[model samples]
Target: SELHEKVKLHYNNFKGDPKDVKEMKERIEIEDE
Candidate 1:
């Protein structure tokens, strides 16, 4: 749950920037693997 919270915080930090959000999503996906 802590990881999820961290991810949420990251999302908030990247909010309103589609490019950053996309990069974040890619990073998360790689981490998931």
Candidate 2:
């Protein structure tokens, strides 16, 4: 599916901005916890 591919692409290309990546991970962890 396009959605699955897009997600994988985002993860692969996510090193564009360090702060953005860090914030995203923090948010995801907070939600999971």
Candidate 2 local Cα displacement, residue 26, angstroms: 0.1
For candidate 2, write residues 1-33 as lDDT tens digits: 565556556656787688888776665556544
Model 2 accuracy (lDDT, Cα): 0.65
- The estimated TM-scores of all candidates read 0.57, 0.52
Q: How well is each residue in 5-33 modelled by candidate 1, as lDDT tens digits?
A: 69868777775679879888888767766
lDDT of 1: 0.76
Q: Pick the candidate with the highest TM-score.
A: 1
Question: Cα deviation in Å at residue 10, candidate 1?
Answer: 5.0
